[model samples]
Each structure stands twice: as C-alpha cells, then as structure tokens.
Target: MTVGTAGDPVDRSRTVGAVGERRLIVELTRAATADDPSTTADAHDIVIGSGDDAAVIDTAGPAVISTDTAVQGRHFRLDWSDARTVGARAVVQSAADIAAMGGRTTGIVVSIACPSDTTVGTVLDLNAGIVAAAHGLGGRVLGGDLVDADQVVLTVTTLGALDGAEPIVVGGARPGDVLAVTGNMLGASAAGLALLIDAERRGDVELLRRHARLVDAHLLPAPDLGQGPIAARAGAHAMTDISDGLVEELITMAAASGTRLAITSDRIPVGDEIRSAAAALDTDLRDWTVAGGEDHELLAAFPPHAVPSGWTRIGEVLEGTGVLVDGRPAGGLRGWQSFGG
Candidate 1:
C-alpha cells in the first residue's frame, strides 16, 4: 500500500513491523522508480531494471563514475530528516560528483542497508527520495541492493557520459585566472545546524519560520547540478565541487595548480539571511562562507575574459602557494573531515 497520499491512507493502525529485504525492495521499487513518469535524454541506454543480480548500462561516450555513501548518525539524523530526505540526499551528493566532472548523469545504482526491525514504510519512503532526486537530474535508478544492518545506510553509485566533452580535472588553472563560484554560498545549512541545536532556547516565533528554511537546507541540500557542465562549456580551466568548505576546496585547487587563490573579503557570497543569522548567533559569517562545508557549490577557474553566464567572480588565481583572503593567510580550519573522530 502507498503511504503519504491525500486520500489513500496507510494502514498504520498497528505498530511498525519488520519486513524481509526482498519484499521491502519490491514495495520500494513499486512506489519509487517503476511508476515514475520522468524521462531524460541521457537515460535511454538502460537494458534492465532493478531486482536483478547485475545491471546493464550502455554509454555512448566517455563514461564518468562517482560514488557516495551516507550512514545514519554520521551523514544525517533520523530525528531531523525522514527516509525520503535521506534517500534524495544520497542521490544528490553522487550526482553532484558526476556533474563536477563535466558529465551528464545517465544512471544510478543504489544500495541500502537497514536494521531488521525497520518498517517496510521506511524503505518505501526512502525510495521516494531516491526516485525524486534521479528524476530531477533527468536520470533513472538502474538497479540496487538491499541488505540488513544495524542502521540505515545508502551507498549510491552514479554513471555519466561526457558526450565527447573534455573531462575537467583538478589541476589546470594558470596564473591570472579568475575564480568564480556558482550557486548560493550563504551558509544556510550551517546556520540551520546552529538553530536546531539551540531552538528551544529562543522564544522568537517569527524567527522559527526562517529557522526552518535553514534547517531544511542543512537536512536536504539541493546543489545547482547544472552549473558544472555550464562551467565546462564556458572553458573552465579547473573545477571542483564545494563538498568541503569554500576555502578548504580552494586550498586543494591551489595545491594542485601550484598557485595562490586570493579571495576578497566582500566577494564571498553572503546574503542577508547569513548576515543576520551570524549577528544573532555571534558567529563570524566568514567562518561559515569560508570554512563551513557541505554547501556543494561549484568553484571553477576561468580565463579572465570568459566567466560564464550565471557564475559569480569571487577571487583570482595568482602565482604563489596556499590561499590568501584579502591578501592575508586563511583556510586554517580543516573542512569536513570524515573519519576524523
């Protein structure tokens, strides 16, 4: 039975019951990808669907591959987000990696692990997220695996085709290249995290609405996946997705190219929401824009004359090493270290 529909209500009259993996997968596929009406130009080569031991995918051009794994309590909180959100996030992060390589997403293989006591409805809801995210990218869920574990885990692998375009790598920028950023870097997710930690400490009802927006960003970030290929088409010399903090990723680019990244103080993308939130929380806005990770914005180094249509120029690539913000040394914080603890 479907869940979360307006009229077709779920039979939740009984307590949540454990369902076996194969049956849970059947229900999840029925609700998520099987009935999806989404179509994309890139997803036509799928010869088979899920439930098979192996999936067959054909690629016309250079195939690009990327994978991401999200585990409960590490990547997300069960209390903060639903299964749908978790599933969608899994696909988004993987798709962003493909886009960062200047390729179009063609297919996705999702593998999920959950506790034996997990409800069938939970997996179904997660499938909804996985399907929605893939559809948004004009891609499809080719196949996946379902297994039993102690906690919810999703390991998503994405395949893409370059369509004859040059695969952009990490170290091609030259001196005097202009550094540009695509998408909002307003630290909405970071602010949302802060608000969630201290939400009950405040009585500002009006602020709660705004708080939810930031919290939602933290829980389910929607990166501008389209900006990547756009940057590539516009002749981006080097590119990297901002999965880490802005400056942290820039440090990577600088180290790769053996150059210096000089960002201006006024150029980092900080909007009114971030500014006001920082003031309210007594936190430096720069810390979030420069050091906070998981914004997933795309950063590219372009020739000064051609910076693309929608990208914002935030800095320049100079002949040196390390990153310099307003001519001073920065990027001291190690951004988003997984397995650090």
Candidate 2:
C-alpha cells in the first residue's frame, strides 16, 4: 500500500518483498511476546503471553480493561506532531479510559501500524513516549505489534486493577448528586491546532506554543489519575473521562444513570490561553469548553458534601435525561461523536 505524504506515494511492494513471509512471522512473534514489568509483579499472575496470541492476568481483585485508538489525520496530524508526542497521546488516551472506571492502570499493550517510509528512529521515539506516559500513570507497556499500513494507527489497551473497590460505572449516579470536574475545560489541543494551521494567519508562533495544550495535553494528558480513586473513596456516585466534550460526556452520564445534568457555562473553567486563541480564531470559547473533546479530564458526581481535591463543582444531577446549561436545555450542538456529521 502507498503511504507517506498526501501527494507523494511511495512504492511499498518492494519493501514488503524484501521482508518476505518468514521475516513477517518472526517480527510478529517478537512483538507478541514482549515482557512487561507488571507481568512479574508479585500482585499479578500472568496466565498467558503474546506467544499464545492473547494475554491473561489474574489479579487479587477485579480488573479494568479499556482500549483507545488514534489514527493519523483524524486524531492527530503527523506534520504537527512528532512520533514521541503521538505515542504519548495514544498511551494517555487509553489511560484515561481506565481512570474513568475508577481504576489504577497496571499494564498496557500497544499496537502500531505505519508505512515502510516511517523511520526506525521515529518508531523508537514513539515507544519512548509510550514508556514515559505509562510510567507517569504507574503502568507499563507489556507487548505490542508493528505492521505496514497505509496510515499511522496506534491502538492501546490498558489493564487496570481495582484494588478491591467496586467498578464505578456510569450508571451509578443518582438525582441530586453534584457534578464536578478535575481539570480545565475547553479547547486545549484544538487551540494548539489552530495556531499550527495559521501561524502566518495569526502571526503568533509563540502564542500558539504557549496556548497549544495539544502536544502536552495530547501527549501527556493530566487525567488526575488519582482524582478518580479519590472521588470514589470520597463517595462518587458515577464517573467518566472527558474524552468527548464535557456536555457530551455529561449527557452520557445522564443517560446511563437515568437522570439529567444542569451545568452553568459561567462556572466552567476556561483558561485565558484558550480564551484568547478562541477569540483570534473567531470561535466561541463556550462551544469549545462545553463541546471540545480530548481534554481527558474526569467528571464525577458526588453527594453535596463529598467534594474531592482538585475538583470543582460545576453542576448538579436532576430527575430527567439530558443536559442543560443554566436551567435551560442546552441549545445548538450537544457534543462530539465518532460518526456525527
């Protein structure tokens, strides 16, 4: 398959020929059996490995499993991001999934597909990013696969241990619960993309870099990983990762819990960097704050008195299904979806 620059297609047939079928099998085998520190941890019992085509972990308590994928162009632009950033972003996104379930990640597996033209050094850098991000979350990548494809696609699966706690699913929320967030709201990464796309149009590379939370946010998502557990310990009724826009995720929580969420736009935190970038781009900060995705913050519902540190009360749960801003139903768009037009 042809892959690389949009207009310049490289011939992959020859490269594939050079590797041949035997080498392909060997690479796949090596990728599958990679070792992970978690596998050797005293708390874990690894029942299977890549050689078996699947992995199994037996922990003392319930396990949490989450998978996330990032595709070039859709999730990130190669021109705008380096390999390390891309890898880190992939790992962080997956880690967020585990946190949403109120679990602490113990291990991860990454699968990557890229073209032959992709540099080996770039791949190594990406792996380094993955390692760094995993370590930040107290986890590690155990195994992964690399294959030739038309585009760069990274898929990460995170495995977590619940540590004897019940899994805080989205359905546990109750009416009258207070809704809160643990991080800044709105366009961090989106603003970064805007700057990169229009450095000349905006004439502010420094400003873009300063506002561009995407590289950092995308690469190293600060998903108050501890916040989820803290909220749970403090009695969170329900929780979810803000992978989609806040409003969008709230709606999901509402649907799952059979209730409605009422949030105040004025209460949502909008950083000055994002606000200025939104103004320059002629976009509404409210829209990005309420609907922009990829922030990876945690949203949880707690009893009025059970607020956790690093979390701000933004709204409340009510007796209905849907989300509202300031007592009125949220108008305009709700939030992002994978297939929404």
Q: What are the Cα lDDT values of the candidates?
A: 0.76, 0.71
Clash numbers, per candidate: 0, 1
lDDT tens digits, residue span 100-164, model 2: 88888877878878776665556556776777777677776566667778888899999887787
Question: Model 2, residue 115: displacement in angstroms?
Answer: 0.9
Candidate 1: pairs in clash: none
Error of 1 at 170 (Å): 1.6
Tens-digit lDDT string for candidate 1 (1-341): 11221233343222134434544556655555565444334345676666466667777777899999999988888777898998998898888888888878878988888876776667777888998888788677877778878888899999887777798787887899999887664567777777766664674545546657677877888878888788888888998887777778888899889998888858877677877777878977776777776777788899999898778899999998888866777644563232121
Best by TM-score: 1
Best by lDDT: 1
